[model samples]
Target: MSDPDADDREGSVPEAATPKKKKPKKKRAAEPSAGGVAIRAVRLSRWYGKVTAVSEVSLHLGPGIWGLLGPNGSGKTTFMRMIAGQIKPSKGELTVCGEAPFANPNVLARIGFCPQEDSLYDELTGLEFVSAMAELSGYDRVSAERRARAALEEFGLEDAMTRKMGGYSRGMRQRAKLAQTVVHDPDVLLLDEPLTGTDPSSRHQILDALQRRATAGALVLFSTHVLPEVETLTDQLLLIARGQVVAQGGMDEIRQLLDEHPHHIRVQCERPRELASRLMTAEGGIVGLSFRGPDVLEVHTWQPDETYAAIGRQVLESGMKLRSITSPDANLEALFHYLVQRANRGSGMGADAGTGAGPRLQSAAEKAAYEAQLDVGGGR
Candidate 1:
């Protein structure tokens, strides 16, 4: 991805112009009780001339790790920037730490922002770059260097600390960026795709560090389109699509909201026609059914549990051979597609017709299934 702040980094802010030290950091308010709100947005919107990057959206988040999920150009970045106080909202209100973030130095100081794009000073070594950011966060020179080293070590970037960012690979640069974001130990961290391009070890370290921060009462919000990545970190998610908030809550909560939609399941069997015929005649939950090929059947049902039980009974009674059963809409990617399609349909925008927008999901199970099919067909 191209760096979004490339131009701003070239015209760097002078050290002397950085915000001066304020009063000793105030003790943060007590952590909210269950269901408390840490960040609140009321009809928030952002626009650049005629382009509306974020539509009116309202949300309430508590202190915890949250996955901000959306597709490319879905306004996740724009919304994060607005909350970080990097840009003013064009409409409505957004508050962090109980105060509007725009131009609020006190609030900004308590907020750590890790942007999606590379915003490093290539000429500076990793340690120096992070130390600079810590200093800008109001830490003195000695404390800044100490914190910088600690943060780099936390992200397993100690070996690369002395290397100039210009010489760092993509993964190394990503870790360096993450290290700086948490160097000052802010109360709220807005991380934009902080794990992108990182190796498995680096990803583990980064997630562990974020988990520690959340345990200490810091609200960590990280954005990514990868479903498995989100599953690894947190259950609380804020899903956005087409510049709007589509849904928010745990996986189960979101799924409950989607209970009205029929679930699509794909089945492969030795006698698909017989299985389909028996299922269609025996089931009450089956809403739709079709044959994909001679040995494959696609079934849509509103009550999946009941339908599956029925399928098992039918197979046992008829002595039919069964191969495998898979639900295509059982993962986050499918939920996202269902919500986006619903949103589009509600707005009179034909779901898959007007906007070329649809859910893109490639889960581990899906990939394995595809590979198995390839092997069976002698194409592997």
Candidate 2:
């Protein structure tokens, strides 16, 4: 489906003025923190016979929230399965809590995983099933019961805890699944689309719980194709494409990858006219300069880093102090969308595959499905 917030292409690219820099080699994922790495994948690769699902993905996750972002069929699930021990990597190593995760009970206790697929028995009540899982995690019966109650309460599922899994609404069932995952108080939480098929209130509740876990020092990783969800939950990002780690880092690092990128920076100063004229001649990377308003100039630059530094230097040299300078174009969504478009083009994955599938335009049925997911406050 075409995103309503898709970029407006009309007069988007600014005229080039400053020379672009020699792009740096993409940085590899960093080593885990000393507090201890929650999960690690080294040269990890997986394949389904002749088709490779994930390829040479190496990442070390530290304590905090990280969003696994990608379009559908971007090898996100395969990579997560490898980390969770549900599926073994065809090559290389993946470890959770410094040990191989596959069938390792000790390592498993450190993890709380909520897969996209439901795995609850129809006859069992939410409370009974989760309490049982908590018990199996090695908690005593009393402790398990208490933990289940607390988790259910946090998810606002206390009232429905006794409801049979078969009769629960999709939103209620999702809450139950989330409660079960956290029942054992695992150190690392891997949630795959945990907010899918929920009302706005439920989605907000789940996001609160996830944020609480991250604040409590757990490594919380969740996957979602929804751009706004990622923007809201975490700025720490792991952007994957076609089974490869295309870009992985904080927001600023990701933005640096866009070549010949021009961004509009709003500058408020004592002398706007003087600032614009001075910026026009500055060397490192000045693309364009225009008056945004009475006391602000919107400067466009190819090398933001260099131009920003140069602007500071000019201010000092001229002994002029500006009130404010902000880059409105340097945002997470724009950078992410640019990267995805570039990846799609480089991979030659059919021009219309990401949003439009064929020349027949969007059908009402597909738009209805998209709107339905949105109305439910779910970004699946």
Candidate 3:
């Protein structure tokens, strides 16, 4: 994927950028310049032995809710962990707020990370856990308590703030984890699957809180495999497949990218043969048509809106009874698969090639997310 402000890094170069330009004597922090990039990466990669997890990913991300989208083992978690300074990149340069994050306490302080594995202390109350996080981020005891409660309220966990996390439900526990991540009000937030076990109400509240933080000038980036989750959070996206970026930008750009694929409209009508015949005489809007059954017509068209409009007019003018209409390939799963299939790879979206779940799910949440994207009556 090529970002507006980032250099193209699809191919291997002569040399990768070196890290550690300066040594830190203390936990000193730094912020990006006015109107500067919040996070930047160049040829960033991570590997284990001979297997590369993230490969040559370069991005220029500013303040917004940027969703890191990919399938199982697409390296979303590894890429995020590198940014949070939990793991060092094997190659390339990564900076958060104009400073290196790896082993740098100051830069790490400006970043909040909510890991996918939410391992909490069963004995501690939600408020106590969040307040401890705040204090660890340099807040005093009194201030930590105040900020912790406020953060909990922001995530709609005010009623359960005093309860022990072990006794809390899955949704409540996720919210508490999010509260601690934002308790210090870090400039960059790296959340991994924050909505895995959330209900619809909790999902709405969590998305609203993230939007508020983005509007307040904080860069909130989260990772998720679910399409609806990202769509509900923000339009800005960084799509990756097989450890490489396949697409970036808003929904419109992604839709436009797969224009070559015909938009399929499945319609059930009283006279399918007559409808197909009528559409055959129209202009260049339709590409082809086939009969699914005696009363069903499946249309392939380049322009769905125009073709559907024409179909509607033909039905109304000819007094044809139309039972139902639906687009089978208009959802996010189709779009994502299209982009992944179109990605510059030599093999299928399977195994190391990315996006397929033939072998590599590291956690139960990943398996669940992958299963959620699967169609009930169709194959990918």
Candidate 4:
């Protein structure tokens, strides 16, 4: 069977069936200008013999903080590793700092990578681990120690600097990893799940440090499954799924693609039934409605702005006490779920089929499957 998600080119249609009106050109994926390009990949693919980790993917990024948003096993780490020169691509081209990365010490020196795996030496203290990384990056012992101390303190690790790596908690260990990655201040930073296992205060500090790096013209690309974390860091996004670039743009552009999906809003008020009844009678835009409790109503509407406006007018005119009004679908998580569902459907997966699980669950399943495949492959 033909893939349902395959793009239909204009030339593929019969000449007789062609419409007289010209169709709008499909927008090409976003690309960075040559002068500002920090990383560029064309048809990049990576595989582990029979298993493909990253499929043919292309991306262009410049000097700024970019969110590499995807669930675990969605090829986020594989792609980052390729850019960091840890592995060579099986096919296609990739360049960092306008030079091929694999086996090139000059390019590698300019790129800093913090792998997801905990690779710290247990015998070393937090300060020693970060200082060792700086020394390896070509700094003298004295300077390395200075930079390491500064980085560690910047990441809120000053009090724990003397503690052994094995004795640190998960959050503290994550901070130590980040401190080492940024100690040398490389031009390009590739951080995989950097915010994982971090406390809120530590997350804030790390984010601030990353933002500072971007402001200083470093190309920062960090991957994460957490949607809110991405929103907090940068608006630029490179969304990946099923080992492919599903979308590349800012939040607004992504949200536009999801306009067809119903927007869900929850309203807390003293008069739930009255408000729901008035909304139903006054507006035909609402597509779904349910009562969460005696004073709360969940509403789904195709026209959110109109629905919201109606709600505001009704509450004031009827003297109804309104506690709060919020839209659950107003964030990146909802957008990711909507796009994943659409992708599945387009690729011949029915909405009710086993393949149509939402992004969160689908991500978990993908992670499990990949890990199992790795185990069968003898942990390669």
Clashing pairs in 1: none
How should the candidates be ordered by lDDT, best one leading?
1, 3, 4, 2
Off by over 4 Å in 1: 1-37, 292-294, 344-380
Output the worst ten-in-a-row residue range by lDDT, candidate 4. Answer: 371-380
lDDT of 2 by residue, 76-106 (tens): 8988887788998899677877888888776
* TM-score, model 1 to reference: 0.79
- Candidate 2 vs 4: which has more lDDT: 4
C-alpha lDDT of candidate 1 relative to the true structure: 0.76
Error of 1 at 313 (Å): 1.6
Q: How far is candidate 3 from the true structure (C-alpha RMSD, Å)?
A: 13.0
* Candidate 2 pairs with clashing backbones: none
lDDT of 4: 0.75
lDDT of 3 at 350: 29
Clashes of each: 0, 0, 0, 0
TM-score of model number 4: 0.74
Of candidate 2, the 10-residue stretch with the lowest lDDT total is: 13-22
- Give each model's whole-structure lDDT: 0.76, 0.71, 0.75, 0.75
Ranking by TM-score: 1, 3, 4, 2
RMSD per candidate (Å) reads 12.8, 19.6, 13.0, 17.8
Query: What's the residue-level lDDT of 80 in candidate 3?
Result: 94
Encode model 4's per-residue lDDT on 1-380: one tens digit a residue: 33211222223433332442244353231122333437877567898988877766655677888888776677888999999998999997788878889988767778889889866788899999998998787655666777788888889989999989999988889999998888877778899999889989999999999998888778899998878989878877777776666666677755655556787889999998888888888784899888999999988898888999988888998898999998777688877776666554665122111211212224656645532322111000
